[model samples]
Target: MPWSDHAIWWHVYPLGFLGAEPAALPPDSAPRHRLPVLADWLDHLVGLGCNGLALGPVFASETHGYDTVDHFRVDPRLGTEDDLVRLVEEARSRGVHVLLDGVFNHVGRSFAPFADVVRHGSASSYADWFVPEGDDFRTFEGHGHLVALDHASPAVVDHVTDVMDHWLARGVSGWRLDAAYAVPQAFWRTVSDRVRARHPEAWLCGEVIHGDYTSYVTEGGLDSVTQYELWKAIWSSLNDVNPHELAWSLTRHSALLDVFAPQTFVGNHDVTRIASRLREPRHLAHALTVLFTVGGVPSVYAGDERGRQGVKEERVGGDDAIRPAFPDSPSGLGPEGLDVQRLHQTLIGVRRRHPWLVRARPRPHTVDDTVLAYTLHDPDSGAAVAVALNYGGEAATATVPAAAWEPAAGDATPAAGDGSVSLPPYGWCVATAPTLPS
Candidate 1:
């Protein structure tokens, strides 16, 4: 039942491999200029039981791999198509899938089309490829160096489709469109339409940070987006243990359930490490519980289980604290990688065992007490799971419908009252039981 609920949002930093980063470049910056250890990284991802891995831009970008120069070629540093193909092949045999970052909103200044526009002053054949107002082309995020493409134009349309077509055939699962807030929704609809027509199983998840993701799920646009506003608020409030702050995320996200599945996640490369939230082992356990039992796939950022909270800011500046070299062992990881790895395996395995989690619908519930519980059901499997978390030092109890999961579970203790149960300190427990399909 909760299996449908688990997903780990993986945020990777190229600096972990390049061993160098440019100050302020975003996490997932392509190591193209300083190619990282491709085989090694892929191997690590496979070991983690990742069903789907969302990769950042791997094209030749000037900084952070966001300033993409070419949409067609895989950056040389990341390796050739064969390496990618090989990685995909290896992962498939192991049951893992891959997603690449598609930063189409902007391109590097040195991009051929942009270069033409710069040299020809709009008279060039590629002149109209970018956004134009009178005589000037619009820049992305106000960086004068990047040129935003005019997605409505015919030639640009053809070029983008061609590139997307190539990637779909390359054995990748889908794309994570960057800065989708800026890109025209119409273009995305066309992109998604064409992509789905070619590969029906290909799922496109866009980056929609502040608003409703459903508005963007149009023709060729996207299947889903990073539902950040709600989660970010929840993350902040929950971090402070402020009861009043907790309801906002649940209520707001609950409202949007009809539109898209919450791409439920905890930490990414951009934020402070998840360990920062794990003040106690139970705190970390609770976060992982929500991460896995919520109605979505749980994403895992590298080095999180090892208790990585980042290290001293390095030269290639970023949230350098987050980009610390992923420790090989927990010693390499301050918490050590080995211990973290074990924790992840246990949690991820639970998610994998219950396919319903990857497939269920969840209902959120909160009470006067200091705990939050959600009910998830898989219509196809008739399995129901309830996950509860008590953030307080002492134990807390919650009442559930008679229809909630039954206590065939060894972890569940009998309630002091009629049938309700109390969960242990800083603890989260998952109860999965069979039911008849509605």
Candidate 2:
């Protein structure tokens, strides 16, 4: 828990980022020792100011990582279990914490238990491990290749619990439960309670898009959940030139902060890259300004710091564009990529200085179609940072609450004697302020 408070994760989707084969390799094929390749990038990750490496599925799977086959074994495409130990050891040496993706809601058709059910029907010892429909079984979100797990089964619960404990004992810091919204809250509570009894420091974050997030954390006994509402609002509002939407989302975000620190992000592996999502390229900075300044456990999707651009569509290989492989090292990157990296470093520096922003409440001072200004204030400490964003074509200004304000980051000018902060077109700012009076 102490380590997570200072975590700024660099999330990477290993299958795509490491250029592994698109589908499962034959059982007899040679293993690929690619996990250590990620180890080589630790310097780049740490240099980027991120203290956590949040990795996508490294477990054996049928296709993409979400369709998990064997939860206990490291995918041969990623190498053996020993490869993972080395990666964890390397990360530990550099003070980087690793969080693995756990796909518990469903399993690939090839999962041993599911395969047994297919061959032996109800007579299979693993028959109760899945949800059956007549001779067939339930699929996840209509994806036939993905078989939904029967959470009600005690065997299934024990399997998931064991898998979590197995990896936690191996040195990973925590887990990110994939498709957790589809699973029952009580089921998570049962499994989490048992896991926590041993590894209380293991952070459990659910992948919840919508519904009662506060309930998911408290009732489900989870440490956190993804802030998808804010992620969508950040891009949608910027594209529509509607800061009011973002303001509303921020209000909801502050409420969640009362319960737990949601995992906040702009560009992740699932969606189009932030660089491509914004209609006006300059608004990219506006999106990130909200990500780092607002309260949450923030993450920088790999390649986003380099201004990577990729659009996700609803087709077979839509995700490929967003999850492209990286070069061997940071030195191989070009000038343009390095420029964006510098901007991220500047913003992250501001965040590192004001760590309390993880739970600071945003008090809206100005909200309009194209402009938003608010103070991220921690009432307990009387600490605050004023953030102003302008999406209009010309210059814009907004008043912030503070006795005095000095520029912290971004292109906005410093606040004046009257507490007014001004910004050029598509500009933003993060500035520190004197403690506010009660």
Candidate 3:
């Protein structure tokens, strides 16, 4: 399985696309006010080799799309449903999939359906749509004015299923379930089976973070979960060049043991900016290299490709500054900009061309505090790729095993073998080794 064989999901957020707003917005307000200038912008993503764009409930007539006011219709403010339809069509034509954020976990307080239910005070037929916890299903402590919906209700179940199925029929590739863990695993299992039944080849990833990914994956509720902590660990190690710490941190992802695939990223709406965390361009490059060439799908956040470093978090004074408009090629620079333009383009090709990257395992021989070496082998296909990372502040060395570098006569790869690999300070190597199954 090449990387394309597995889904390397990416994202295009509405809040980030359009600048963040004040604390709130009216139901009739316009969000993502920048969609009109987004064609060439979006086209650039595909051009840079992103396979998909995880767009939102652009139905968010508000700041961030997470506060979805309407699930059935696209936000007229973002663009018309026809605009979205065209986006899907255009992206598909370029081999890009469009996955919308399904936010059934919650709805905006302004949502008409839920509002009527509140207004009618139980007399409304749609009252069962939300979690009936006294009079305040949409608010608590007077913050995050979101109406948590009831997934257990038949009406809600049917409604969500219908919504996903509708998009599937309209050629949407899949969905990114929001705050998936907050919803019961049983509900996800039900929705998963239903959606896959409708589109057997469809992809579904949960927003479950690293803390509970092992449990999440074991339950068979999501094909993959966001690798939040994993990305963070990798980011910290690469920036600091702490191979020992990186290796130690990666140990938490039990997915590394069993056959598992999850999404990896350095930053998103809720996390620290990757550039801010790891300032070295090469360090970031090294982390991203593992992200792509390692097992599982590698997700590139909007501004990650460019080295979007600025103030730290809001405390560090960099809350909303990183989410700037997609910068154009500088003079002769490529569309994704200079910082990571070539690296991303090149790695995307490498991932697309290699099977070991998609289906192989990250078989690290060891990470002895300074040197990190690993081999990826497609046990089923016998293809392999070896990786060596030097996390020491100074240079280090390693050697590849002969058995891992040559394929057996009748197999696609060679049998297991070992050798010491070499490396330089904070440097890494990505190369396919020949190998056989036996």
Which candidate, 1 or 3, has the higher lDDT?
A: 3
Ranking by TM-score: 2, 3, 1
Lowest summed lDDT across 10 adjacent residues in model 3 is found at: 406-415
Q: Give a tens-digit lDDT track for model 2, residues 1-438.
A: 367878999999999999999998998899999998998889989998999999999999988889999999899998989999889989999999999999999999999998898899889999899987776788899898889999999999999999999999999999999999999999999999999999989989999999999998899999999999999999999999999999999999999999899999998889999999999988888888899999899999999999999999999998899988887777767676787888899888988988888887799999977789998876666778888999778888877874567788888754566677778888888888667645
lDDT of 3 by residue, 121-163 (tens): 6799988888666546744224457778887887877877888
Ranking by lDDT: 2, 3, 1
Provide the TM-score for each candidate, comma-separated.
0.83, 0.98, 0.85
Candidate with more favorable, higher TM-score: 1 or 3: 3
Best by lDDT: 2
Using lDDT as the yardstick, the better of models 2 and 3 is 2
Against the true structure, candidate 3 reaches a TM-score of 0.85
- What's the lDDT of the predicted structure labeled candidate 3? 0.66
lDDT, candidate 2, at 350: 88
Which candidate number would show the highest TM-score if scored against the true structure?
2
lDDT of each candidate versus the true structure: 0.64, 0.90, 0.66
How well does candidate 3 score on lDDT at residue 38?
A: 47
User: After aligning candidate 2 to the native by TM-score, how far in Å is the CA of 397 from where it should be?
Assistant: 1.2
Each candidate: how many clashes?
Answer: 35, 0, 11
Q: Which runs of model 1 end up more than 4 angstroms from their true locations?
A: 1-11, 18-36, 41-47, 132-136, 243-248, 277-281, 311-316, 327-339, 364-366, 402-417, 436-438
